[model samples]
Target: MRIQWIVSIVSNLVSMGLLVIVMGQYQVLNIQKQREEKLKTEVQRLANEYANDDLSKVTMEKLLADGNKTMTELEAAMAKLSPELEKKRKDVDACQAEKVRSFFQFPKIITLTRQCLFSIFYPIHTNMND
Candidate 1:
């Protein structure tokens, strides 16, 4: 009977330790979710400020605007710009290769701005996953 009681106590302690670890993971997950929400908010704000700004103007004119940008607006802008930028780059490269004086240069300012914007959220996710 004494042996059985000791065994039960040890099992309970082990279960408790596992419970604690699971709870710790849950806490971390919750914190990460909050951070993700914050990042999404900021991303939307930036999208409205920089891209698809015409939508913002229309929304303001209607007076029904939430004064915040949606992901759809941002995505639409990216879809339109990505192909156009790629084409421009290809054209410039072709011109340069043929020894032609290409007037086109990739915009470093935009690239740096995008890097700075996304760097805020990406490192947090990378470190958390590790």
Candidate 2:
């Protein structure tokens, strides 16, 4: 009679452990299902937001055409200004060359001015002595 009671107790304990394991597996599966459902809902919402509209498509094409037209106009304008830009660049270069030449001649100009002043004052002093 004692052996029979021990066997019954062991069987009950094993069944309870198996039940606990099954419950934990079920909770894990339920959590995974909820996550999958949430992801699916989010994906559907994104798809709706980005869905194509005919008016939007036409407007996008029109904008692209306008952008292309503007780019062509800008390129033509730049081409038309090329000669004028070259002329201006040459004029600037000539002005810079003239400035450099004047800078180099500055010392010579100063020496000439000093010689002229000495000549004018020395003659006046000599005539007064005479």
In model 1, the runs with Cα more than 4 Å from the true position are: 52-130
Best by lDDT: 2
- Score each candidate by Cα lDDT: 0.83, 0.95
How do the residues 1-130 of candidate 2 rate in per-residue lDDT, one tens digit apiece?
9999999999999999999999999999999999999999999987776675556788899999999999999999999999999999999999999999999999999999999999999999999999
State the lDDT at 52 in candidate 2.
51
Question: Where does candidate 1 have its weakest 10-residue lDDT segment?
Answer: 99-108
In the predicted model 1, the residue pairs found to clash are none
- Worst 10-residue lDDT window for candidate 2 reads 46-55
Model 1 C-alpha lDDT per residue in residues 1-130, reported as the tens digit of each score: 9999999999999999999999999999999999999999999998878766787768676664443355667788999999999999999898787653322334665688889979988999899999
Off by over 4 Å in 2: 1-47, 51-59, 125-130
Candidate 2 CA-lDDT value: 0.95
List TM-scores for all candidates, in order: 0.38, 0.55
